[model samples]
Target: MRAVETGKKPVLSAEIFVIPIEADRFLVYAPLRRAAFVGNAGAVNFLADLREGRGDSGAGHDGEMIEFLRRLEIVDAGPETPPLAVFSDDPNPVSVTLFLTTACNLRCAYCYAAAGEGAARHMPPELARRGVDFVVGNALARGEDHFEINFHGGGEPTRNWPTLTKTLAHARRLADAHELRLTAYLATNAVLSAKRLDWVVANLHGASVSCDGPPEVHDANRVTPGGKGSSASVIRTLRRFDAEDFPYGIRMTVTADAIPRLADSVEYLCANFRPGQIQAEPAYPIGRGAGAASAETAAFVAAFREAQGRARRHGRELTFSGARVGTLTNHFCAATQDLFALTPDGSVSSCYEVFEESSPRAKIFLYGASAGAGGGWRFDREKLAFLRRQSVDRRAHCAGCFARWSCGGDCYHKALTVHDDGEFAGTDRCDIIRELTRDQILARIADSGGVFWHEPPERIAAEGCACVSCGDEGRIMTGRGVKKPDRGCV
Candidate 1:
């Protein structure tokens, strides 16, 4: 027998062992750890067979051998190493958007807030302040120095100026007292005046305004509750702020009604308001407006690609938040985990849609914490775990997805609403991501003279999937599976 040194044994034992019949070496199995390997050459093959229940137990019996090997620890020789930190250890806390009020003056039909006369209740100033304090204090306790506090609304955020001002002031004070950094942002319709703009500039780091495309598309989608077009007013307000050098981004929600003029809408935005960034979201099926059809989504994506080209032609930089890269990548839905939404009442959600009481995933909320006095602020880890589990478990299809790491699987609410599961299922959303990423890669490859490496495989797959039905088998195969694309291949 080969003299084998023994070390600390594993806590778990194996149920099966394999030994070579011709050689003196044997093999030990540790099914519990999903591992098995060769042992010392001194061990008899017949002894190994007997231990494995394949031979007469008394023939090659070595009771001490079984015990000695059992006491030995197996060393891993695999190349991959475990990560130093797990996903949960990431320092950035999920963002939480707080909508102070649902009472918007403009009546965008697709408004998720359901603002206006019959929407949810508006959060009062005190309640809004409490929510801010709760978030700040909670973050401080977690040793997180910075926190993102976004103010969203059902109607116009400025309409609730009183609450907004107080909340900002309160958040700032709490940030200072707790030695934390706080960033404020707002998503509005851009219908406020100079005074309101000044207040926003002083309090908020940035703002996002809603505009469909040009005046025509904007006017068609955004109207007051009274049915009056809001394009003229919105454009006027946006220009006023733009002239003042207010930092803002243009947000457009593409709908079935807006898809026909997608290219024009993109052109309209580029021409009228040269924004810092352009963000587009397909209309979700909830509240007044339901989900846009697959055809409409495809059309919007095509138009959006054209828009991207137009932006480049004019030397404007356009970025997509959760868009796929090439044929290998998937849509990046940062909001699912990277960003969070906090309601006016201090209830935390993954996003705005999750704030709706009717949403199955909405139950995950940060009410209040025990470390802070006067207010209770807490992040529900259990709920987050549940959500994370659901994301990984239900979306097994996404596990092998090339865009799995980057995309984080589109909107959870969209998955739940459209597919009846909070997990992403195959849909046109994947197509949209693939097309956008393919365009991006093609442009990059052309610019680099077609000699580029380190290009993401997911991006390539996304590009490949865009042209034809790539199917969801996770691997692209050619002719009897004799040749297969990379894991990220289309």
Candidate 2:
């Protein structure tokens, strides 16, 4: 250890890395010593002193050790900002997954859209036109130069070919009219014929097909309404696309039934059909799978994690769509701001899981239907305001969390699902998030030659503001006596 003198104190100096295990737990590794601290005080003090330009002293000071120091300037932890809110005015809505048709060719055991009922109606051409117009107009109004539109379904979007074709044509017209750059995509079961595949290639920017794992795992849950397995057909479709070198992704919905063979599922997909991306979404207990037990859910999570770990080592990227990434550090869920889900009926929502009718937090604005004439669109500004206000309440559990701003309280749906109320705070999910975040930070530090701060690039860039969409722009306009668009009014 190199010894450095700081005002007569001999500070032991060497490069070190630290990852937070949780609010009270952390993994600290230095050339001289490796230990885990149970609280923030020691780490906080050490970080503070280092930020103030104090070099590490060879002598390890309790709660203030200069143990390992580096020549690099520490990354500053900027003020907290809410998640998802950060992109309120993102130049363009990066992606849109439209429920083109609710009709389905198969009946998955865990379908979230409840596809079998007459509720599985094809979006009328007029409604589809309105929906496309709403999204495109909203993007242009916000000054976004580029956008992506994704066509999806409650059952199968391709089932209603005529309607879908019309919608695509309408979307194209809107994009062309505005001269906005756009990418088109589709998420389907691929039960359609080769002709449909050709159409997709010609019109879509990309496609995503559903697969559980292997034939056994996939067939166990994804079966036709007549009880026939659809796995063989799905694989056939994928093989065709793979042979054509079609660009696509795989969407795997992890359920309790599929957990036991999670690794097999991932391996099967990776080995057989190389996809651009793999997304693992946990089953939500609604629609077709509402009766699924919690034990099965837990099993699925374990299996999914195991499979994901292996796949990652093999150079595959697996995204945990439903998992909370920043829970330990902050209380704001990224879905609340980062992305907005526009329902087929023109309801703008925050998270896909929460229905607009059930949760006020989900409603951003309702378009197409008349507002007060029993059918017009209505922008629920009050509901949106309530959600924004509640996001920063700072509960008891959040008082000591160091990554509070970064985590943004995990997923709001997880909170509501696990606790039965959106207003409730804290969960076991936070513990998992803290551990993961700490590990990621430590890993980055080590990769950067050790001795690193815990803050991430996004966290360092964040600046607390009253509105995520407008940020400082709103204040500037207000000072200039210009009327700004009301929050949630878009």
Candidate 3:
């Protein structure tokens, strides 16, 4: 609160936060001001000396630095603005993820929900109808022209085909009545009946299949409840999807053992399935995988690079969850945006992994239910207050991170497992998020000449990424014009 210039000798800006990229270059970002500045080593030194009261403002070099920063409006102090309101008053969305049932055909080793092969619970028709009504009503109130519904859950949604179909039918009716465009998505194990497969292919806007990779790799961990390999059925499902021109992608959960085979797995998947996209995510130590350690960071990065290269050679795009370029966000996913995920029992859960009210984390994640008067759904503002507190601005540790907004301090559920408090401490994947984010940003700038998502790419230093480890490498563009380099790290 002291005057920014205590002695009026061109004091360093109170808003600027510098991240050194090299001895002569730095990435200066102001979280409060929402700005990023690239500085040369001279500017960095000048700023450091100024802050320490050793800089000579009379020097031409120092004068130029001050003038440049003054032009940026950080040199002069501004009136104190209140903390950024990252949380919205209306935490409502025009989307819903319907958990058709808590049952699955396969028991993957890393299954976060331990779905299926357990106490199976199917969502009642009444609850499903109410869930749809809740989201549709919000859409209507917001005057949205379209809304989305994703059929997904801890267990295989297709397993409860009756409830799934009924819910979709009810949602479709509501959409028609409201004259809203209904965009539906599906996430399935793909080990389903021919009728279900056909319905999904013909219905969904897009679908994500839970497939590890080749049979050997996939079956090793993703197995049937009765100790049988589920690869054959899933492979058949993928083949059917491909044959029918169904727009779908494969999602792989990378564990410690799967890390070594990642590249080979990508190659095999590309050779066999030719999926539209391959999303690979390292297993988080949650649910059934709680006891298992995640793959080594260096190992995962190396394997990801190799697999990415293999995927590129086959005209496929390899990606990881929350690793996309040109996307600047303060939350990792849509959970904070009021996207509802209805449990089989009709409990509204913010975190997909924390579905059961019996869960210890339920108090923080479970925010609503279909217990409103006349069977409508009701949201709990008190529980939602905890969720609202998780915005990026609330995490002090993430203030200096370049990926602070992109990753949003990682997953809330996972962050809770590691931290004993409400304030986000992030998960063990902090390093990975930072490195991957930096790599993606540099790769995008290299390909498009800037990071236009947050601002024009020209705002970044044009000389190229100053990271010495990555050096100057050619940025490869995918079919979608998204740039993801197969090599390099921050």
Q: Which of candidates 1 and 2 reaches a greater TM-score?
A: 2
Candidates in order, TM-scores: namely: 0.68, 0.71, 0.80
lDDT of 1 by residue, 287-347 (tens): 6664535333667777777777777666665544444342222222223232344455446
Ranking by lDDT: 3, 2, 1
The 10-residue segment with the lowest total lDDT in model 3: 467-476
Candidate 3 Cα errors over 4 Å, as ranges: 1-40, 47-59, 62-91, 322-325, 421-424, 448-454, 457-490
Per-prediction RMSD in angstroms? 14.9, 8.3, 8.1
CA shift of 182, model 1, Å: 3.6
Would you list the C-alpha lDDT of every candidate in the order shown?
0.52, 0.53, 0.65
Report the C-alpha lDDT of model 3 over 11-94, residue by residue, as the tens digit.
555455566666766666443333445667766676677667675434444454565555554555453232332544544556
Better of 1 and 3 by TM-score: 3
Top lDDT: which candidate number?
Answer: 3
* TM-score of model 3 vs. true structure: 0.80
